[model samples]
Target: MAIDRQTVNRVAFLARLKIDDDKIEATEEEFNKILNWVEQLNEVNTDEVEPLSAVNDLPLICREDNVTEGSQADKILANAPMAEYGYFVVPKVVE
Candidate 1:
């Protein structure tokens, strides 16, 4: 696809870019090159190819989920600077 100065200017305005008048031609050329590369990709045949999420086909391993009460409150509270009645004490913020 051919990219013109007007198209480049419109894209620049939408993207909020400040392209100088001297660089408009260069920007248009770059846009045309990218569009040409994309057009080339359309010529490739992929009818027989299968879509894949990853290269490897290995199945993901998972573990069973279990529920249990945690019993390490004393050990966890040991690091607290100020703890009372098995809880952390901080400065009151509400009036």
Candidate 2:
């Protein structure tokens, strides 16, 4: 698809880009080249190709689920900028 000067200006406006009048021509040419490349990709045949997540497949390492609570109430509270009574304190937002 060939993008003209007007389409390029509209695209720039929609994208919130500030492009000078001189740069619009170059931007239109660049956009046309990119669209041409995408059009070329539509010509390729991929009937037998299987979609793949990764080129190499490897099983993830398995580990047993373990849960244990640790006592660090005072240590964690010490790192907070404003903590009150073993909890983090924050500024009031609701009126």
Candidate 3:
């Protein structure tokens, strides 16, 4: 599809841009060129190309999931101003 002056004006309005009267033609031409270039992408053959998230195919390192973060209550509670129940003590926020 070709871009017209109305399309250029609409795009400029939506994008919050102020295009002068003398520049509208230039802006429309540039927009048409961009649209034409994008239309050329449709001619490329991607039938055999597989969709991938990344270009690299690195194997992820798998590890056994286990609970190993414990036995540090005293070490962690040392930084709290008040720790009666092994947790950070903060001012009551509710009325």
Candidate 4:
């Protein structure tokens, strides 16, 4: 797909990218290169190939979920600067 200067400019604007007038041609070339690569990928035959999430055939290892954290209110709030009624207190920001 051929990308024009107007399309490049629109993309840059939408992405909040600051593109110089001199760099517009370079940006357009990069876009064209990316599109060409995608076109090349479209030419590949993947009809018989199975879709995979990972290339390596490694099994996902998971541990049993246990109660590691004990419910000790005083111990947990020991280092807190301001804590009251089983909660951490913070400075009021809103009026």
Per-candidate Cα lDDT values, in order, are 0.91, 0.86, 0.90, 0.93
lDDT of 1 at 64: 75
Query: Of 1 and 4, which scores higher on TM-score?
Result: 1
Which of the predicted structures, 1 or 4, would earn the higher lDDT when compared with the native?
A: 4
**Candidate 1 vs candidate 3, TM-score winner:** 3
List runs of model 2 lying over 4 Å from the truth: 45-95
Number of the predicted model whose TM-score against the real structure is largest: 3
- TM agreement with the true structure for every prediction: 0.47, 0.46, 0.48, 0.46
Ranking by lDDT: 4, 1, 3, 2
lDDT of 2 by residue, 1-95 (tens): 77999998888889999999888888888999999989987787878878778877988788778766558888888878999888889998698
Specify the highest-lDDT model's number: 4
* Residue 89 lDDT in candidate 3: 80
lDDT of 3 at 23: 98
Order the candidates by TM-score, highest first — what do you get?
Answer: 3, 1, 4, 2
Pairs that collide in candidate 1 are none
